[model samples]
Target chain A: MDDLPSLPAKLARLRHAHPGDFNLSRIDPAAQPCSRGGKAADKVRVEELAVELDGLQNRFWADRRHRLLVVLQGSDTSGKDGTVRGVFGRMSPLGVHVVSWKAPLGPERERDFLWRIHAQMPGNGEITVFNRSHYEDVLVPVVEGDLRGKALQRRYRQINDFEQMLTETGTVIVKFMLHISREEQRVRLQERLDDPEKAWKFDPKDLEVREHWDDYQRAYRDAISATGTRWAPWHVVPADSKTHRNLMVATVLKATLQSLDLRFPPLPKGLAGVRVK
Target chain B: MDDLPSLPAKLARLRHAHPGDFNLSRIDPAAQPCSRGGKAADKVRVEELAVELDGLQNRFWADRRHRLLVVLQGSDTSGKDGTVRGVFGRMSPLGVHVVSWKAPLGPERERDFLWRIHAQMPGNGEITVFNRSHYEDVLVPVVEGDLRGKALQRRYRQINDFEQMLTETGTVIVKFMLHISREEQRVRLQERLDDPEKAWKFDPKDLEVREHWDDYQRAYRDAISATGTRWAPWHVVPADSKTHRNLMVATVLKATLQSLDLRFPPLPKGLAGVRVK
Candidate 1:
């Protein structure tokens, strides 16, 4: 944040999707909207953001005044896992947990969708990441035609209100939608199938989902338009390049944590001679 | 680990304290036993080690084959907190936890000493760092003469047995004794008292402990010699210089994890086209 200090306004206005008339087509997934210079300069800038983030998290952990929820939602091969390892690898397990959500299982499917999601939310002085999240309930259901019209609108409203309440209670929410081009997805999917080590990540279900690529993209755009609230605006990260995807998310996270101006808490009573006087 | 690969054997041999004749005096707190070159080169090497460490941790978390316990034991001003920030700052909160142990209280005191220590050991696929550890039980009691002779010897044996059991169950243990000179400690303690921001760290009890410097050193020497074993040897870090202390610990941790040679576990059956053999 200290080094990438100049991009705050540009970052928000460029990548943040606005409500109602948000146009996903205007943004290019391959473009480096937040890149400082060439790839080399951008890579170095990301490292700076990572170091600054580590420093801020130290204070945030000590501050104990705020909780953090980071949602990473994207296509199957759009680099959510990479973002976790590259962007958040430096933070300690003392305060952060990464929750990779899959399809709803027996009991999770039996309850209201947010029940399991709510259970995983970060507590005070902690960070909980959803590698995928309730955002999926909106996406998959809408794409499959199971949820639409009044029901679809209701789901989006539920997410917006839930996020607002969390913010009201001192949790900072940051949502990211990793937008990768259709061509990039094809290449990534092929790579997963071709590389034996990566073959394990290649789900036949992903192939079935990829067949409805355009439908999924349309679903994502609608969800962003409906749910991009003031409390938790969605940062649509360009995800064709893994480094830029990580760089943008790291920059935004640092900026958000920095905005709080976290500080060390006051010393405990009778220690350091700090008394009420 | 790969870049600093040349120094592994020498690293273990030079700093590792032997069981009975673990003479703490011969080791100079200011000496650079593990310095690659000068300060600049050592700083760069530490960064490389950190990056490599990040990569290994990713595999370790996925491997889920072993747990890791790192014990950082030292005097009041020997840079334990700084080491946590500098050496392990790059790790994610998903896999690594830094626990600062204070004097055990209430129920912790009600039970035997190892009770709380055992409760905090790392689970599978996790790493837990003890900013201070159960070793304090050995040091404080013996220094105050509340425990001595055969009683103290029994406590040491109990600790050794507990650690050995943990190793037998698949936890890799690395113990570091951050050895700083008495004069270095005096300066640090004075700085803590003088700097208002750092004043909170100055404990009044620490001053009382510093007065018995020689007795504490004797106690430390005894503890290290007694508890140092095949499963967990004490790495006596020359920690007057903060950079070297972090550098040495990072190198040792990298090497230790490297020896494990973690790999990705086999993918789940019926997924990735892997069926019965």
Candidate 2:
């Protein structure tokens, strides 16, 4: 009855209707590899989406009041950086803004994780992306002895309420938890080490956490299950392949922006040419 | 005699050398018919520069301390916005930041014009571009009657000093005044009026200013000649063709960035893969 479709059912229908579109080659949490059939079609769609996104971004610049925020959360090597470049690459310069959350600033470190994030929220008619977001506070700190017990519980509550408020204030939060198998991450990390161009990406710090990969998985499951909601829902994306990752993300992004029914604002009439003679 | 080449000659050499490296066809600032050049070498060179620019932009992101400032000033339909998108599109989302100055904000209008521009100056390791800049205080207001006599002279002095300060603090200012013949502008204005898609771009107010084109040109020449310095200089780009324009601008941008000699910061050793066991 609502104007919006039930997101869960919509996702389920999409998965069923476009079974070939799903990237099965990506192993799930269990480390068992799955394979899919429509890689070529998926790639073409992504290119199309990139161009459409350019138009949408330009429209956002022209319209000036609608702002979009994309949140990417996932295991290491889930293609967050690449997706950002691929999906939003065609956007015009002034229309989009991307903030990748790393170590917080001095003031940010003192306050809650969400405080710094809130500060970077997009103004009207812009798009802001969080490469790794507030979820890191819950995921990283909880897994690594940075925060524990009641502090963790309080954070989850704060995150839910914070997102709800953001949604109420015209922010559309599309959260993606990039799901990948331990085996895939191992292979990916090895590739980073082997490829000279990618060597800069190889951080030995990733392996220490790789040992406790199961703990991180459990944390992600809990965080996603708890925070997934009507206004700001979480999408569990299988991201073993970069192409699949870009397509899934673009499909969701296009659907979300299109739902807004963006159109060019009417220009003032008689603006053609003024007679100065 | 310095490591830097002769500024004026170096820029002119670069522009002439990269005839095929920029796309100047799309930016027809005149009311004439479109023309095509059949130089395969030029087409190939333009493509090469596009790729090179991608690499340069990545290095810019990795370097982080070298900020880029592209200042675009031009007549109506001079293609400033298009140049920005075409030239800087491939840069990392993190490194490039664009600030388009408009009729002053309430707070901005009260303070000196240079004040608003200064606040938007790029932080260390970022790129800040001004679509139109503080020159407007001296250029537009003088042409429009909003500024005159003692006030105009005072503002001009304030701007030159302000820019010197920005250069002193490590801002690399590359100013471009897009130069199109009056006949070219007439063609562009008519194009906007003729094409429905571009109908929104035609503003009658622009024509009122067109009447005083020579006055504005004289003002531009005086201001640029006065303010051009070793730290920051204005490049007057001929803008009759978009291909020539894009190539010329990209070459200038490349020459400026290459001169910076950016290299990736050394990564901390031992930060790579830690044993998870």
Candidate 3:
């Protein structure tokens, strides 16, 4: 990847667009499109970027002008948790929040799909990361054949409108799809089974979902094509290499924060030299 | 203070229950009733207790059988935020959540006060800390004369019944009233004005409320007496000394967690010796 151009320009190449020509199978999940160099170099760069991002986050929190919402959507074992720890872990807990979306229960199920999601949106000066977000509504339903045709299209439209409204009200949105190959997932799943420490993370239900891999890929592609609007575009990240995945996310996030031009508010009047005593 | 007895026994002295003789003017805000020793000793003990509490929180999260809700209510500069940081900050953010309540805005005002609060209640295996809580309904409204007579009594009854339902459903509630002297608040508020970094936290409306200090104090006393139940007892914490305040809160919390007898859930059958691979 070229380092001379603006970060957004570099990232735009990986963003999913041109729906007519979009095909999930064409993108190689093992590709390192965003890598600065070798795995060692990429890992170092991720750490550097994480630090830079943390500085931006401090300014963003002090700026109190914009809300940032990051939505991470991917297949099971696609590195959502890893991405959060790598990219957002450096930020202050006071300013950054993570909401891991699980299956709706009780009252949440009674409301609209977006109800709970809307409630968790980032407030001004805050950043909220959604792990497996509202996008799940479109993917799981389509894969399970619960939603089809017009109903699915309506949900896509609803998400687009909702996101547009959020953007219009000063929320900066970034959506990432962590794409990993089926073979890579198999190795990870096996590793989870082999490591006692990782066993707790391996849900048996993941295997059931793996059986519908093709359907899920199709569902993901369709949903991304429909809902990847200008306001909230989706970046399909090739995530087979955990280091590369972290690097790419941290890079895109740093670029996003830079674009905001965050700055701290001016000190209150007459407090420049005021003594606490 | 003696350290020989169990932790709960030491903390029992701070838990308020006598509604008939409950007087806001009687409790000394500067008293260190729950402190283990001098300021330096209490600070170290607070740190020790915080780590201990973190261990218990891990077990609590893994247990997934009980829910914990911590309510922190106090006047301005009463150290609600400090309590969260000093007491619960060491715990994993995954298991601990903080909801800093502000004045009702938009649709929150449309519904009853408890509606928003009820929505934020902890799910199983989670601990939620409410910086300011549902008790605000009684204090703010009563001080402003919007709630009084039979209407106010009804709200107290409603709160009692609501808490009873939560306790029946396996939620353990701990309420803390951070009592700070009026002079101490004035000093803290002035410090905020003097320090540029803390200026943002200094809301001008705080001065407006400070003018109603006596009314708010009476309101707090009334609310605490009415809503404090056996299931959700209120502990009046002397918060003039930040270290002492943290120590008392942590000591009370440590005792509360111990009382629950938190334990990790049993591993899945066949997984005790099963290889992950």
Question: What TM-scores result for chain A when each predicted structure is judged separately against the true chain A?
Answer: 0.93, 0.85, 0.95
Instruction: Please provide, for model 2 over A163-195, each residue's C-alpha lDDT reduced to its tens digit, 9 standing for 90 to 100.
Output: 878878877777777777777788888777655
Q: Between candidates 1 and 2, which one is better according to DockQ?
A: 2
Instruction: Provide a comma-separated list of chain B TM-scores, one per candidate.
Output: 0.93, 0.83, 0.95
Output the TM-score of candidate 1: 0.75
| Fnat of each prediction, in sequence | 0.21, 0.25, 0.05
Q: After superposition, how far is residue A168 of candidate 3 from its true place, in Å?
A: 2.2
Better of 1 and 2 by TM-score: 2
- Which DockQ-derived CAPRI band holds candidate 1? incorrect
lDDT per residue for candidate 1 within A116-158, as digits (tens), equals 9998888778888888999999999989989999999988889
- CA lDDT, every prediction? 0.81, 0.69, 0.81
lDDT (tens digit, per residue) of candidate 3 on B1-277: 1121345564565676434435657778899876766888888888798879878887787777899999999999999977876787656555677788988999999998789989999999889898898899998989998999999999988888898899899998888999999999989988787765566777667878988999999998888878767788888888899998998888878877877776655445654543322
Candidate 2, which segments miss by more than 4 Å at Cα?
A1-44, A110-114, A144-154, A191-196, A202-212, A270-277, B1-47, B110-112, B123-125, B145-165, B202-204, B270-277
lDDT of 3 by residue, A1-277 (tens): 1121346565565776433335767778998877867888888888888778878887898789999999999998999977876777655455677788998999999999999999999889988989899999998888998999999989888998999899999998888999999888888887777665465577777878999989999998898888777678788889999998898888878877887777756556655554332
The residue ranges of model 1 lying beyond 4 angstroms of the native Cα positions read A1-28, A58-67, A89-130, A133-166, A196-228, A263-277, B1-26, B59-64, B90-95, B102-126, B134-162, B193-219, B264-277
Q: Estimate each model's TM-score.
A: 0.75, 0.81, 0.77
Instruction: List model 2 lDDT by residue over B171-199, tens digit each.
Output: 78788878788887888887777666566
TM-score winner among the candidates?
A: 2
